[model samples]
Target: MSLPLIGTLKLRGRLTLYVTLLAVAPLIISTWVGANTTRQMMQDQVHEMLRIEAEGLKDLVEASLVERETSVRSWAEDSLVREALLTGSYEQSDAVLSRLQLRYTTFTGLVLFTESGRAVSASTPALRDSFLGQDEAVRNAPWFKAAQEGHFTSATLTQEDPVFGMQVLHLAAPVMESRGGRRLGVLLAAYDWGQVGEVVKAALERARSRKNESFALEVRTASGTLLFDSRGQDAWHVPNAVAAEAINGPEIADVGDGWRFVALSDPEEVYATVNKLRAGTLVGVLAVVVLAALAAFLLARGITLPIARLNRVVRRIVQEGDLTQKLEVRSKDEVGELAESFIQMVDNLRETTESLQRGTRVLTETVAELTRAAEQQESNITRQAAALQQTQVTAQEIKQTSMVAAERAGAVLQVASRAEELGRGGALALTESMSGIQTLRDQVDEMADQIGRLNERAQRIGGITQTVKGLADRSNMLALNAAIEAVRSGEHGKGFAIVAKEIRTLANQSIQSTAQVGDLLEDITQAILKTVELSEQGQVRMEAGLAQARTSGDSMRALSTIVQDNMNAVRQIANAVSQQNAGIAEIFNAMTDLSTMMHDTMVGLQASQRVTEALREVATQMQQVARSYRV
Candidate 1:
């Protein structure tokens, strides 16, 4: 299926492309921002955890020191150390020192200082078990001074032993007696600092979860000496490098070795929790995306499918030439109306085409019938002209015969008049026949009547000739006009050109055919002039033929007078000759006039035939022009 269009769009398959972007873009932005916030929050949480851990360690360490100090104070109040203190006996003090050492193995030493600031019994294993009488710790140290003021004392942790080299967490307390006795001395205990190192190591172990992490717990004397490091690295050794307040404990003052420390922590639980949260969110996001896509597909289909169908209808219009393949009237939407309008237009066009076809057919048939009639008319004209030609020929023959008869009669009558001069008995009888010549005058009057009617027919023929000449000229003009129209039509008039040529041919025939008519007219006029000339000739011939008649009449009269002279045969012969001669003269005059009239008629018919031919040519040319546009 081809994609649908929406204002030149080609990808109508997914309307939700923008919708998905709109939904997802902000979602992704929020996710990114949330992830960054989570990371910062995790860092802060770690920092908070570290601070709480350090504080907890400080409280635990302080609690452990207080317990140890209370235990040491109990030892200082012991019957053994007090008895030894009262007697001031070295052997008994040695016994007390041995007991103290045996009872508190956690301590480095237990020393009892007297009121005079001497160590009476010391857990130091060599030489006199005593602080010297002038020992500064016994006399003025905080633990010793507190003991003298009747307070139990706690000692600061020392990196080295009091009299040796081992480091210890020191604890000390005062000895007091009842029964009006006041404070006697201070008993101090030194613990191995190794225990503090062990506690720190344990806490470090507790803190560290993932690999490659360690912890530290450091302490120092007021004079900045190497005290302790839980992590036990050389970080404690750099003087002036460690930042102040790293440990944030009273014991941290004068710490020598370490500043910044890394606490190793296991990440298994943290990563597992992070993984759960991340996986759940990823699954939820994927679910949402899939749901959104499904919804998007459904939403897109509702719009795209209809559009696609509309597109197919439009394609049919373009490709198949099917204007009828319009969208159905599914709704009152714009596309539906547009399709309906298109169909209406197509229907109107089809009807118009049908009407045009019918009208053109009727016109074509009518024009064709008219053209055929013109052709038939041309045929009839040809036949008529041919028939008229025969008439003209007959007319010519009659005129020729009349001229010969009239010429011969003149010669014969002259001979007869000359014979009258030899007037003897027969001659005188022949001359006496002239007195009856007046009887021949009646025959002359009858011939003149026929001549007058022939002249009238000639006049009628002349009128017809003029009408034919006018028709031929009109026809020629029509042909020229058709040719001009053909030229004006350009290439579309090629068929018209052929028709024009045919019209010109027929028109050319008009000129040629009309020449025959003009010839006939000239012949008619010549014959008219001939008739006038022949009238005079006929008058002379009439005088001769009449003279012969007169001579014959005289001969008849002479014969009547000479009936007694020769009643046997000559008079009867003369009467028979006179009757035959008068009949011949009348027949000859009628033939001559009729021939002249027929010649004139032939001339007029020829002109008419030429005009008919020219008209037929013009119609033929029109027919050809019409045929050129047959398609």
Candidate 2:
């Protein structure tokens, strides 16, 4: 949808809008999409890394529990512990328990309890004072039931212990008979929960600082009791409401029995990076839009300024009727070519106008000179009429001289024969000249055909040049992609990188060569254009010359008629001299009138032909100027 403001904006705004549509919008969309994709990918990678670390921590905790279970089972089967529990012999059992405690220092305390929850022996003397028989809490404990069921159980319990203050895990193993396999008592070992927490914490720490975000480490029981939280926000080792909220979000790994390693992920730190990327993208997008808008404005200015100048020049010419205005060609681009063409058009028009003016002046002078000569001929004919009247009176007086008249008639007949020979020769010359003109016309047509063929070849060359350019561009793109892949391959792709570089260089050279070929084609096209134009002009001139030659042939036919008329007049003069001298004056007057009329007609025909040729040239030049514009 377009905004209302868009319609109201000028050329600059339109250009800016087009630029944004063409350049900026796609950039923003691609950048945003790429950033989001990267963020999702990175988030998935972080989750995978955290899960792997969690699994490792789970294995460590399980190994710790397994080792404690092994030690407890071995002690539970010992004869000293069984004797202490069954026979109430604490001296030997305590000695053995002390030795066990010394070997595994992580066991804060150890105890031997009977099947009925009575304390048999203790590893620590201080904890022994508090050991109770018939205690409900001890008998009801989950680990106690697990031990009676002949299974090793690790149970996390929070208490204020002297050695390991906040929380401890009790590892229990059941003691049984060697032969009958009867239950005897339970052996218990207190492993500080802090040791297990250190393992979990270490695994998390190794992964936490690597990427994405910071997270809290937590150890919980299957019953949703939070045992150890690295956050240290809950020092009492109590179940936290906030921490429970994250039970669904946190990733969990089972340590053993019911205990779990939970990592409560906090993504704020990781998303902070995504936020920064988004901010930078917005900033860069804004920068690109600003730059694009600025370029659009400058581009609009460049185009409009030239158009305005051209319009002003055209308007001036239209108003003033001046064909002398010319535009300055500032660049070698389309606008410059348009200006150059317009200048040429105006120059051609001016030259044609000047030629017409000169032709008109010469025609006027020719008409004036012809009128004066005709007036002089009319005067000479009037004097010859007066002479004919006197000659008639004199000839009537010479009617008696028949012999002289007959001699003059014989001489007149000889003159008539000579004139007939000259007329026949002139007619043959006219026929030969017409044949030469026809040959010239044929040659002109053949030249036009050859020039047309050259134009076609030029077009073919242009297409070939374009094909080469496309191939070069494609090769360059392929080389660039190859270089990118080589760089991605790092040290292994050094040889390929060298090959790609050479390919790119060759592609560039090919592109340059194609461009040079294209320039040559343009030159050829221009030369062909000029040749065709010259041929057309020559054809036009040849046609005009043919027309003039035909006109001359008609004049020659008329001259032949005049020559026949002169011969008839000479015969009439001889007849008048021989028969009646009275008719001689009339024949002489008729000859003088015919001569004056023919002279005037010849002068008018010559002037008309000259004017026609001049007008034809003007029209041809105007057409050439008009052809320069394509549309």
Candidate 3:
């Protein structure tokens, strides 16, 4: 369906495809933007968590240092240092140093200098050996001099050392008499400043400062002597301008690195603040994104489901060629009307096609009937022609027979005339003979004239018979020519062609029958010849009879004039009887010739009718064959 629709664009709607594309474009754009937003928000959330974690550990380290300092200060006020200094015994001093060293790892050296600036009891063997020696640091150190004033302490810091090496927190206090308040030597306690340095390095890790973001430390005594400081060329600084704000007090500050910044000092406080913002923002964004996604899913489902169903219906109709399928769209919209119209159109087209087929069938039937009738008529004509030809043959035979009879009658009549002449001569001689002779002579004269007329009549009948025979022959020839022409015409002239074949048969029959007529005519000619010979012979016999009649007439005229008159009366009766007999025979022969001609004509017509009838049948058959060619 999709491929065929691409082939024919007319079925496609004007705005349907465009509107779908329009809807899809925005959906795609919205999905992309939403994904990007969610990604940015998640990254922000992760970074904030790392920063807050860094700030949290920073505060814990600071608090640990403060507690350490307070614990160490209170420990120094014990009577252990005064006792150690008063005894100064080798074993006793070592005992106190060892005892105090066991209390803490921050201590490096604890020494007591004399009023003359001499070192006294020490915490370690090496430092004890160096005591009472004039070392500038041991003799002129801030702690050494500060002990003259009593109870002055230095902050924990990085500082140089002479007796036991570098130190951190150094505190000094004057020892007074138990009874009168007299001062013993000053008590000096040196702390390892490296311990404080460890605190600062620890702070850097806890603060989450980069390896390049460094830290610095410094300390000053009350007399203005610099006591401890964490300053070295190798030190990695806690580098930041925002650290200046932290320097004012113990509070959090924003430290600016070139690319970014962070607040520290209150490690937990910064963590709590930034993390609160991060968790809230993440949850809010998540809620919004989830809501949006759910709404989009629901919306897409709602819109696309209807469209998909519509597409399915369209595909089914197009693919299957089933116009009966209609849209099931519940909405009363344009698409619904379109489906209805399509169904209606298909129904109308089917009905119209059926009606057209019916009309064509009726028209075909009418033409077939008319064609059959024409062929039947032609067949009838051919049959009639055959019959007509038979009749013509009969007529020709009759005409020839009549001619022979007429010829014989005429010869008899001529012989009768000669007898009449001989009869008049016979009447002069004998009376009895003369009476018969006169009758014979009168009959001969009348017979002679009648015979002459009969001969003429025979000739006429013969001429008429020949003419009718010629006409019949011509008609037969014409029928044969027509048949030959039809055979030459091939299948196209098959109707006429069969008619021609029938005509040929009719012609052949007519020809044969005519030949029979010719044979009968030949027989009639022989009979005529026989009649002429017979008539001549009859003439001779009649002549002999006429002479006898003449002698008799002579006798009658001589012997009795009255008898001669009676003989004259007998002659008149003989003349009338002989003449009537000859004339009647001639008329009968003429009638016979006419009957033969008529029969021949009838036969010719019948033959033609037979041929024509056969032709009509052939025409009807041809029409039927032609009808077979139609679908």
Which candidate number has the best lDDT?
2
lDDT of 2 by residue, 377-470 (tens): 6566567656655655555455436556778786987789698778867877987898998998898899899989989988998999899889
Error of 1 at 47 (Å): 10
Off by over 4 Å in 2: 152-165, 204-213, 234-259, 271-278, 306-631
Tens digit of per-residue lDDT, candidate 1, span 1-631 = 2334433444443466655656766776777677668756765675566555555555555556666766776787787777777777656666776676787666666666777677666765452343564576557776567666655433444435556457665466667775546666667776676776655666676656533253345554335444556656544333322121234344532122232222323343333455566677777777777777678768776656656776776666556545344346565666567657766766775455455556556665665666566667657666765766666566556656655655555555554444443334565555544444444445545555666666677677767766766777777788778888889999987788788778777867776776687677677766766666666566676567655665565665564454444432433444555555556555555655655656565565656656656655655664544333222
lDDT of each: 0.59, 0.72, 0.54
A best-first ranking of the candidates according to their lDDT comes to 2, 1, 3
What TM-score should be assigned to candidate 1?
A: 0.36
Error of 1 at 390 (Å): 96
The predicted structure with the larger TM-score, 2 or 3, is 2
Q: Model 2, residue 498: what's the lDDT?
A: 94
TM-score of each: 0.36, 0.45, 0.27
Span of ten consecutive residues with least summed lDDT in model 2: 241-250
Enumerate residue pairs that collide in model 2. none
